[model samples]
Target: MNSPHNPLDADTLRRLQEDVIDSYDEELELEVDDRILDGPAGLSDEARESRRVYFRELFRLQGELVKGGAIKRITQRLNPRVCRVAALPAPNDREKTQWYFQRFVSHLPAAGEIVLFDRSWYNRAGVERVMGFCSDEDLEEFFRSVPEFEKMLVRSGIRVIKYWFSISDEEQSARFLARINDPLKQWKLSPMDLESRRRWEDYTRAKEVMLERTHIPEAPWWVVQAVDKKRARLNCMHHLLAQFDYHEVEHQPVHLPPRERHEDYIRNPVPADMFVPDIY
Candidate 1:
């Protein structure tokens, strides 16, 4: 028996609850990626041996951000989600005709939410310019307008922190070769990536111009030397945390309530065939 005002039925509510629990579980597994997540308050001897201090600090920063501390955490180094992969796909005919920044506007974070862009609108200055996807006029206009647009975003209470993860040619080459050899990483190799590698000089020129023209006081760029991925992650996270003034949240202690019980209730089990075989 559901009320008309309650839009979510029991089944729908159950599914939503399950989805949230599953997502939390998945987020927790990232702790294994950097063992420092166990306790940000203390750096154990094991953490020191594993060089987990960097990761621990990163997780701590993220926790502070979650607690409404004046911080925003965006992890990028070696993490594709922090880079170009998070950007929108190629513009369709209609999108191209609209305002250049229209598509990106929707992705902007609201108050207190930290929106991390893998590759931002600067794609026009970087990839699009180098790949000849945009005209010379388009490139010039983007360079001219981006500073003003960023200033507007900043004025609107948005913190526009830009980062350019710079890695060497030799390092990139080695990474590409490693990916080619590893079956697990084969999906990372795309025709566009291969083409980009060939046009390295063009990209370098575009990057230089983009940085020079769009580097405004309101939204300055921070270049991260990303030859060593781990160091880059640590350095970037540390820098971001330093830029903010954050304090730990004071929370009250929690007590678990006892579960309700019904003496007449009985639990039922499904048939053995309903279970999946555990080969492992």
Candidate 2:
């Protein structure tokens, strides 16, 4: 499909869906909507409210996994053997992303290779540039800084693995529609989404330039067929783990234990005068 307006038939849809799903982070999806919601002007009133409801429900579940303390290793969040999920948001820009990631990264319970899902950091590819979200000079500065940054990361004795998940205009629209139509997935949509959707070709052009400029021998963007999402994720995971030359990572050493002890640990009652609690 030359343009985003072009619709894909059912067969095309399935193949494209698989491609989109392939690029999924297994743990983090990192889509346009997420980037928009996290940064930029933000979402609309109704859409924001809708997203609030979705994230509340979604985080409640993710939080359950966290508080249950059933999962100790960070990778377990993505391990298909443990939690089989597809297409999640990667908050590289968020303090929580940077902080939690630092913690999660420091301790790898299992041995595995480290492969980058997105070969080139997305900020340069299409996300920051074409959208006018990032200034031209800022974009140039980022490009100049990336090589040295990556050089250091590579010298750390960590293998630099990068994968560029590419989707056609047809494929992107299909997934966008899927997000729009599916309520469970509706939170995936954002106001900036339509704006980006309109510029599929322009984005593609930027992606090409991004690859040309940034693809270094040390860490280059690997353009993968994104017509199928599962294929992309599995391929990415396989490549990533392979980098580590890892032996079998022990399954959750911390088992998903049944709720053992329960107590009414609710705020303990204090003496009447000792503590004057808030009077609602």
Q: Best candidate per TM-score, number? A: 1
Instruction: Give the clashing pairs for model 1.
Output: 83-118
Deviation of model 2 at 99, angstroms: 18
Model 2 over residues 201-261: C-alpha lDDT tens digits? 7888887877787788887766667565544444444444444433333446677868656
In order, candidate lDDTs are 0.69, 0.52
Off by over 4 Å in 1: 1-86
Cα RMSD for candidates in order: 15.1, 13.9
Clashes of 1: 1
Candidate 1 local lDDT, 64-83, one digit each (tens)? 44444111235322233322
TM-scores of the models, in the order given: 0.75, 0.51
Top model number, lDDT: 1
lDDT of 2 at 233: 41
